[model samples]
Target: MANIPLEDIQNDVDTIVSEWIDLGLLKRGELFVIGCSTSEVAGERIGTSGNKQIAKELFTSFRKLEEKTGVSLAFQCCEHLNRALVVSEDVLERFRLTEVSAIPVPGAGGSMAAYAFQQMQDAVLVESIQAHAGMDIGDTFIGMHLKPVVVPIRLRQKNIGAAHVTFARTRPKLIGGERAVYSKDQAKSMLCD
Candidate 1:
């Protein structure tokens, strides 16, 4: 496998996060989940070649994103931990999430998640969360952590290092059938009592 420069990894993350910011879907303080596989980023199969240095670069970019957007972050662990997430204690209390017991290691939780658990001031593991938005780097599968009615976001920057990337934003489910008026203008025209 080819060696992916750490600088490239950081640049890709920054670019992707910038696109996410431009979308304007994620609000301040909203939960954003991230699922990444450092091994995949390094041009290897997921869980085969975990790299701490790659995780560090990705983590740095994500921290910058948090500072710029004020969005809370959740780092999803690998399937070994049943895809639980690493989040700050504040996020846990704010969302009333149930705490889970585990300390993520590179082999078990994944390099990205394990790094996040260590860097966070008060990191805690949670069984689950319904995040408002999310990015999946290296096909780690963040869908289970996102809220219902997820809208896939297509970004110009599609890859982080050697891994494919996907993004999503959640919105309230549109209910009602044909009779439903979705906009204020339509409601005014209908004039229902």
Candidate 2:
């Protein structure tokens, strides 16, 4: 933590999310899976300590990402539910996603996800998903939350605190074999190109 002030964290988040958008890592209405480890932000093991302050900082940045990209967020829970995500009502309707019933707590949902749930206007827990893009903070394990094809994204900043971060966006799973010629442009378009 370097005993760094919380402001630095907030600023870092804003910078990262914006950079993610600018780098064509995400787009409007696409699902943005976030698997945050608040403990790591507080200089602890992945799930050892869920700090509200860190969650709030991350949430502020996430909201900015939401506003700028119009990307729907899915807060990935911990190993519980195999890291099933919670999405907004708009996301549920857009993707016809099923809304399970579960409210995130600091311990159960991890602080970052719980904070997102608190800030979101309309939120619902979903048992499964195929998200368009995702950021796994502290390696909360968001692979289960992504779509059929996941493309890794390398961010300018590798780790966002003590947590190791990973980002990826999905592509339409290529089904056809030798005869199939997938659109290269379509793949690039997935990242908001």
Candidate 3:
């Protein structure tokens, strides 16, 4: 895949977020997980073609997305770091983050997530989260980190340059067994009321 322009990247992201909005997958100021592999975006296996330049473009696009949508960004690091997440201190405290340690580097944390680690104002590694929505670009495998009840999202702008992109918005899990009549509104509200 050729290096995509930042503007194009933003457009793709914008299209993605717009669909989430339509689906009630995300709301203003909600937390969203993003796990991107620059190598995959460039049509290579994840971590094989880590590129800081490509990472920067995607990060910029994410930042703009956050600013426009009022959504918090939670970046999932590569498996080298045990898939730890880089989140803001505010989110940490609000979510009662469980302390963890690791410095992300190329091939370990993947370039984009590593870049997030370096760029965070007050970064911390957390074990888990229940994000409202999430993007898994290049098969970063973020399902374990997302909230339960992952629902797939289809966007018109499919591949972000050869790397398949997938999105999810979670809903509450059904606790009781049979005879439990689920509230349609309750399930819908989990994604969007």
Candidate 4:
């Protein structure tokens, strides 16, 4: 957008992440995935135009989230790279994810992912991951990186710039019949069953 305010975009990110923290959907020592399309944010077709300014705004917000929550962030690349992700080596080691070799540029990986890769400490390309929660900016389709049992979240700030936003968090899959009770009190019984 010609008049896109970086603060507003950053605020949108802050609000969604705050909601996740408030709901306990995201916690410390977890992974958060982000899929952003800077072109869509600028009111252009996806992948046609990548904006580093927009990416910088979004990435800064994500960094704030990480600093506050102690959660790791992963950036998902565009389809040119088959939507592979960039994450810190610590996250790779923790999750046992396989590392791939490739340097992301704006054309291939999209602006946001490429910017994130540059910003991350010990960044590495990974084939896949099972994140605990995530945000999809501009319909970038981040769901593929989230853990199974994703529950969609509706946030107050539904869009960042012109891009549609989607938020989600994962939970442990429920695997029992009608007779099964699911609660903290039943945790031991379920685990011992």
Better of 2 and 3 by TM-score: 2
Q: Per-residue lDDT tens digits of candidate 4, residues 1-193? A: 4466778777777787676666765688899999999998877889998999889988887887888788899999999998999999998999999999897899999999899888876999999999999989889898889899999888787888888988898899998999777787697777888
- Displacement of residue 89 (Cα, Å) in model 1 is 0.5
Inter-residue clash pairs, candidate 4: none
Q: Candidate 3 on 1-193: residue-level lDDT in tens?
A: 4666656665666676666655654668678999888888877777788888777777776876677677788999888888888888888898786868777787788888889888888887787787878899899988987877888877787766657899887788888888565987766777573
* Model 3 misplacement above 4 A: 1-10, 175-179, 184-193
Candidate 2: worst-modelled 10 consecutive residues by lDDT: 1-10
Ranking by lDDT: 1, 4, 2, 3
Alpha-carbon error at 4 in model 1, in Å?
1.0
Off by over 4 Å in 2: 175-179, 184-193
Model 1 clash tally?
0
- lDDT scores in order: 0.93, 0.79, 0.79, 0.87
Instruction: Please give the RMSD to the true structure for each candidate, in Å.
Output: 1.7, 4.9, 4.7, 2.7
Per-model clash counts, in order, read: 0, 0, 0, 0
Question: TM-scores of all models?
Answer: 0.95, 0.86, 0.83, 0.91
Residue 98, candidate 2: Cα error in Å is: 2.2
Q: Predictions ranked by TM-score, top down? A: 1, 4, 2, 3
lDDT score, candidate 1, position 119? 97
lDDT of 1 by residue, 1-193 (tens): 5587888888899899888778777789999999999998999999999899999998988987788899999999999999999999999999999999999999999999999999999999999999999999899999999999999989999999999999998998999999777889878777865
